[model samples]
Target: MADPTLKAALRGGEFIVAPGIFDMISARMADRMGFAALYATGYGTVASHLGVPDAGIATFTDMVSRMSRFAQGTRTPVIADADTGYGGLLNVRHTVQGYEAGGVTAIQIEDQEVPKKCGHTPGRRVIPAEEMALKIEVAAEARRSDDFLIIARTDARTTLGLDEAIRRGKLYARAGADIIFIESPESEEEMRRIGGEIDAPLLANNVEGGRTPILPAETLKAIGYNVAIFPAIGFLSVARALEGAYAHLRRNGDSHGLETYAFSDMNELMGFPEVWEFDAKWARPERSQAAE
Candidate 1:
C-alpha cells in the first residue's frame, strides 16, 4: 500500500478526487465520506491555523506537526503540498523525508520560489525550468520507497503562460517526477491542451473561486487528468458557516434560529458512542476481576 493511492487513481482512467482537509476532523469526515484520499492543503492549513492567506507564512515544522495529526486521524492516504520544498534542493530532500515519515503517500513540490503564494493568486513567480527539474530530481531521489510519489507542480501558467507551464511540466516529468501538475490554467481549452501536451500522469488543482474553472471529476478524467484536488472547499464552506453563526450569536444573543445538531447528535457524530462502549467493556471486565 506504499504508493497504491496514486497507482489506484491511475488505474482504469479513474480520476482521484481528493478533498483538501486542514484538520483532523475534516480529514476523518472526508474519509467517512469515502473520498479516495485527503489532500493536506497548504492553503487551508495556513488559513485555518493562522487565519492568514496562503502566502508562505507557515513553516516546515508547522506543516509537519499538522500533517502528522491529520495522518493519525484517518485511514486515508494523504497527499501533502510541500510548497517550494521549503527552500532549495537540500530542503526539498528533507521535506520529502519528513512528509514520508508523517505517513504522506505523496508529496507535491512546486516550481514557485520560496515564499510562494497560492497558484490562483497573482504575483506568483517560478524558478528556471532546469532549476526546478533539479529540485524534482532531488525530491524523487530522497523518497524512502518506490511507491512514495514525487509530484512536480509548475506554477508558470499564471506568470509566463500555458506553453511555458507545459514546457516546465514536461521537464519535471523527464526528471523522474511521477506526476506533472500545471497549476491554474486559464480556460477549459487550456486545460484540455495541458492534458494533451503533458504525457505524464497529471494533477489538476481546482481552486474555489479562483482563476481555473472548476471542472467535474468525470470531465477531468476524460481530459487525461489522473488526480483532482479541491483544496479550498471545506475551508470556504466552513468559514461561511462560522461567519453566519457568529453574526447570529452577536445579534440575537443566542443560537436559537440556527439549525444545529443537538449535543447528543454531535457527540455521536464525533464517535462518543464508540468511546462509551469501550469504557463499558473494560469497566465490566475490571468489575468481574475484582469480584474474582
Candidate 2:
C-alpha cells in the first residue's frame, strides 16, 4: 500500500520533487534529507546491482528484490520503475501485487516493448496504445489499495511524435492510471503543451544531459507538473566522486588529502551503534548477570 503521508501530500496540490536513489546508502541519505518521495531509478539500480546497462536484461525477481530493500529501508515513499511490468497482462498483475506488497507506493510501467532501452536513447519502440492501456488496467485493478498508484508512461514522444504521446497519455488516464508520464519531451515548449493538454497529474523526467531539458522545480510547477523526478543526479554525482577519488589514489599510491565522507559517520549511518548496543545487552553474559 502507499504511504498515507505521500498520498495526502499528492492531494495537497503541491509539486513534488523526488530524487533518485539506487542503493541503501543513497536511500538512507535521501531519507534523512526530507524529500517528499524517492524514486527507485532502474538505470542506476541495474548498473549498481548488476554492473550493466538498463536494457531489458534484468528479470522481475532481480528488480523486485531490490525494490523490497529500498522500500523497507527508507522512510520516504518509494516510486519504483517496473519496466514493461516484466511481461504481459499476467506479468503486469504479478508486478503490481509484488511491488505493493513490498511497500512500494507507486510503480511506473512504460509502454516500451521487450528489450526496452532508456527513454532518452534511440532505437526504442513502444507497444500499441490499446495494448498498453490493458496493462494499465490490470495494474490498477491488481493493487489492493487505491493509494498504491500506477504511473503510466508513454515513450511515443521519442519515436512517434509528441501528438501521439499526448493522445496515449489521455488514453492511459482513462484506463485508470493515477499518474501520466510522457517520456522524453525534447523541448520546454513540448513540456508546456503536455501540461496544458493532459488533465491528470503529470510527471516530468528531469534527466541531466538527456534529451529533455532539466528545468528548475519552480519552472516545472509553473509548467503544471505535479511531480518531477531527477533520476540520474544521485548516481551520476556518486560516479564522478568515485572516479575522482580512485584517480587520486592511483596517482599518489596512498590515500591522502582526498575529501571523503567520514568513516565514523558512515558507521553511525549504517546503524553500527544499534548493533553495539545489542551486543552489550545480549552478547555479554557479564552485563546480564550484573543487571540481575
Candidate 3:
C-alpha cells in the first residue's frame, strides 16, 4: 500500500498531532492507540539507542535505520528528524533519498552546526542562513515523491533572536521547504508572531519540559501551526513507567501492584492473535488437515 501523505493531511485547519516514537514498540503503540501520525524523534533515538543526548551524534545511517523500523512496523505516517542533513547539500540529498526510500512521509532538517545541540537546549550555533537555505532546496528536490515534505527548522529564535529566526524561516520557505519550524519559541507571543509571519505551513516542536509551553493541539492550530510534534513525551513516559516497575520489584522482590495486567494482556496488545491467524492461513495444507 502507498504511504500516507502528511503534507496533504495537514493542509486543513486542524493541526496534526504526532507523538514521538524511538523504537518499533513505541511506533506500534502509537499506531494502535490511533495517533494521527508518528514523529521519529532524534532525541528519543539518541537516548534510547545510544544513551546519549541529541548532540548531533546520531549519524544519517542511525536515523535511517530507526526511521525504517517505524515506517515498516506501523502504518501511520512518520515524520523523521534528519539533523543538519548529516552534512552539506550533497549530504542532505543523500539523507533525503535514504529517508524517502525508508518510508518516511516527511523529514525535518535544522540549521544548527555539526555536533548540534537540541533546539530547546543551550550553547548551540547555526550555519549561515544562505547555506541552510541551499540545503533545504537540495532536500526539497531530492525526495522521490512530491508529497514527501521537507520541514526547515531554525534554531535562531534563541541564538540570534525571533526576528532572525523569522528571516531564516522565510528564506527556507522560499527555498522550497514544505513546512517552516522556528525552534524554541519562548512564549505564546513569539509563536503567534512566527505563525503570522511565516507564509508556509508552520510546525511546532512541543517537547516535554522544553522551552516551548506544553499546549494542546487546538491551541497550536489556533496559533497557525499546521503540525505539532511531541518529540520526547513517549520516551519520557516509558522511562518513568519502567523506573516505577523496577523500583517496585526491588522493594517487594516480586511484581505486586505492577502485575495488575496479565502477560496475556501484553500479548494481545502485540497482536498475538494476528500472528496465530496468519500461521493458520499460511501453514501447509496437509499438516493443517492432520492437525484438524
Candidate 4:
C-alpha cells in the first residue's frame, strides 16, 4: 500500500508531475491541488528553513523529518533528495532505510562526489562512474519495495560532460535504478537528444532560473520523460509572496499592499482551518469528555 500513489503514476506512459515541496504545508497543498506525488527539494528546504544556501549543509535527519511530516499531511508519495545518499555507497543502505522507515515513497541518490554540492553549483564534481553505479546498486538492494523507486541522478553533465552524464545514467540504470536523471541539461536540443537516447524511465529537473530551459509540461510529456521535478516553483512562489508581504508592512507601517493576498487566503492555502479545528477542539475538554 505504500507509495501506491507514486507506483500507479509511474506505470502509465504519462509523465508524472512531482512538484518540489519543502515543508508539510506546501506538501499538503500540493496534494490538494491534485499533484500525483511530491519531490523534496534540497535547495528549497535549506533556503526556507535554515536561511542558508544549499551548500550541502542540510542534514539527512532534518530532511527525513520534513518528509515524514509531508507524508503524514497528504498521504501522497514523497520522493526525497537523499543528497549523495548523505555520504557514500556505504551510507546509502542506511539512508534508504531511514527514508523508507520515515514513510517516503522513494529516494534519489546522485553521482556527485562526496561532500557534494547542488547540481547547479559551479564546482560540483561526480565520482567515477563505477563508484557511483555501486551506490545505485546499494540503494536498490536496501529498498524494501520494488514500488519504492531509486532514482540515480548524474550531475556529470556539468562535471564530466554530457556523454559521460548519459553514460553514467545508463550504468546507474543498469545497476538497479528504477528511474534515472541527467541533471541540468542546458538546452531543448540536449533534452530531446537525451530523451530520445535513454531506454529506462527518464526524469527531468526543471528548476526555474537554472541552466535548463523551462519547457511546458505537455511538451515534456510528448518527449517521453516519465517524471518531471520542478523543485523551485513552489518555493519561488513562497519567497515572492513573503517579500511582498514584508515590504508592505515596512513601507506603510501597515499591510495594505498585502491586501491583494489576504491572510485568510494564505491560511486557506495551508488548510489552516484544520489546524484551527484541532486547537479549538483541544481547548475544549468538553468535546473530548462528551465523546467519552
Candidate 5:
C-alpha cells in the first residue's frame, strides 16, 4: 500500500520487528529475513553513506531518496526518519509531501532546530513547543495518505528534562500526531510515566549500545509503547566484526586466523548466487563468457 504507516497504527498494538537499513539491499535483506517493518535510519544512513553523524547534514532529497529505495525493496512498510523535517514549518510541510511522493508509509519528525544534532548527541536544542506544534500541523496537512502516519518525536526529556518533554508530547498529541516518540528516556520510571501520559500510540527507538535504556520487546509492549525500532543493532555488530577481521589480516597476514561464519553460509544468507544470476540474465553477457 502507498501509505503503510496508517495500517500499522490501525493495527495499533501488534508486535512487529522494525529493522533499520541504510540502502536498498539492506532493506531487501531485512524483508527476506522476516522483518515486518523497516526503519529508514538517518543516523545509520548518514554515518554509513556519508561517514558522518546525523546532525542535519543530509538534505530532504537525500533522506527521501533512501526512503524510496527502502519502500521499493520491501513488501513491508517503512517508518522513515525526517530529521527535524529539514527546517521550520514550511520546510516540514515540504518534507512530508516529498516523503509521501517517495511512498513512505510513515515518518518521524523531531523538534530539533535546523542544523540539529542527533537525538543521541548532546547540546541538542528544540524550537519552542508552539513552533514545533505548527510544524506538526504542517506535517499532518501535507500527508496525502490517511494511512500514512506522522510520528512526532521529542528530544526534550534529555535536553529540557522529562516534565517539559511530557508537556511537549501532549502538545504534539493535541496537534494531530498519530504516534509520539519521546526519544531516549533514561529510566523505566520515565518510560512508564511517558507511556501513562501520552494519549497517542507510542513508538520507541531501542538502538543497541545507545544512551537510552534497552528494554525487551515484551517489556515495551507492557509499558504501552507500540513499536520499537532497533536501529544500529546489526550495524554495531557488523562494524565490530569487520574491524576485527581487518586487524587479524594485518597482524596474522590473512583473515583465516579469525574464526568466522563460513563463506558459503554467508553467501547463501546474502543471496549472492541469486543476485549474480539475476545480474547475469539481463546483463547481456558476452557469448564466449556465458559459454565458458
Candidate 6:
C-alpha cells in the first residue's frame, strides 16, 4: 500500500517541502532529515544513472528500477516522476501500477508528448488536454489504493501560455488527479493566480536556475501551494562539491585538509554496521563448530 503519511500531510494543509533524491546516497541522507517527502527526480536520476539527459531517452524499466530502489532504501515517502507515462493510455495504466507495486507513494505524470523535455526547458510540447485527462483517469484507476496519489502536470504554461496550463490543470483534476501541477509559472503573481484559480492541491516546481522564481516555503504556502519540490538542489550541490574535491585532488594530490563526510559515518549510513554484526554472529558460530 502507499504510505498514508503523504496523503495525511496533503490533507493537513501544511505546505510540503520535498527535496529531490537521485541516488541511494541522496535518498538515505534525506530519509533521516524529517522532510515531509522525497522526490525521485527524473532529471537527476537519468543523469546519475545513465549519464544522459532527461530527454525521454530513459525507458519505463530504467526509471521504475530507480524508483523502487529509492523507495526501498529510504524511509521517507517517495514521489517519482513518470515522464509522459512512457507511451499511450495502456502505458499510463501500466506505469501507475508498476510504480505502486514498486512501493512509490505517489507518481507525477506530465502531459508532454513522447520525447518530452524537462519542464523548465524550451522545445517541449504537450498532447491534447483531453488526452492527458484520460491518462490521469487511467492512472487513477490503475492504482491499487487511493493513497497512491496521481500528480498531474501540465507543460502547457511555457508553450501554450498560463491560461491554457490553468485550463489543463483544472481538467486533469476533474479527471481524477490528486494534485495539479501547472509547471513553470514565471512570477509570484502567476503562481497566485494559479492558486486562486485551481481548487485542487497544487505543486510548485522550485528548480534553482529554471524559469520559475524560487519562492520561500512560507511564500509558497501563503500563495496556496501545498507542495514545493526542489528537484535540482541535491544533484547541483553534489556536482559543485565533486568539482571542488576533484580539482583539489588534481592540484594537491591529497584530500586531507578538505571537509568531507566522515568515512565511518558514511559506512554506517549505508548499513555497514548490520553487515558487520551479521558477520560477527556467523563467524563466531562457525569458529565454535570448528573447535568442537
Alpha-carbon lDDT, every model: 0.86, 0.94, 0.87, 0.82, 0.82, 0.94
Reference-based TM-score of each model: 0.92, 0.97, 0.92, 0.90, 0.88, 0.97
Residue by residue across 1-292, what tens digits does model 6's lDDT show? Answer: 5899999999988789999999999999999999989999999999999999899999999998899999988888999999999999999999999999989999999999989999988899999999999999999999999899999999999889999999999999999999999999999999999999999999999998999999898988887899999999999999999999999999999987889889999999999999999988877556768799
Per-residue lDDT of candidate 1, residues 221-267 (tens digit): 88888899998988888888889999999999998879754788667
What is the lDDT, from 0 to 100, of the residue 244 in candidate 5?
90
Worst 10 residues of 1 by lDDT: 1-10
Which of the two candidates, 4 or 5, achieves a greater TM-score against the reference? 4
The residue pairs in collision within model 5 are: 6-147
lDDT of 4 at 133: 82
Choose 5 or 6, whichever is better by lDDT.
6
lDDT, candidate 2, 1-292, per-residue tens: 5787777887898788999999999999999998999999999999999999899999999999999899999999999999999999999999999999999999999999999988888999999999999999999999999889999999999889999999999999999998999999999999999999999999999998999998888998888899999999999999999999999999999889999999999999999999999988877466769799
The per-prediction CA RMSD against the true structure, in angstroms, equals: 2.6, 2.1, 2.7, 3.4, 3.3, 1.3
- Which of 2 and 3 is ahead in lDDT? 2
| Candidate 4 residue-wise lDDT, 49-131, digit = tens | 88888877877877778766766667678888888988876778988888888788878888877677878779998788898
Q: How displaced is residue 190 in candidate 1, in Å? A: 0.6
TM-score of 2: 0.97
Per-prediction tally of clashes: 0, 0, 0, 0, 1, 0
Error of 2 at 258 (Å): 0.4
The TM-score obtained by model 3 is 0.92
Model 2, backbone clash pairs (residues 3+ apart or across chains), number? 0
Q: Which candidate is the best by TM-score?
A: 6
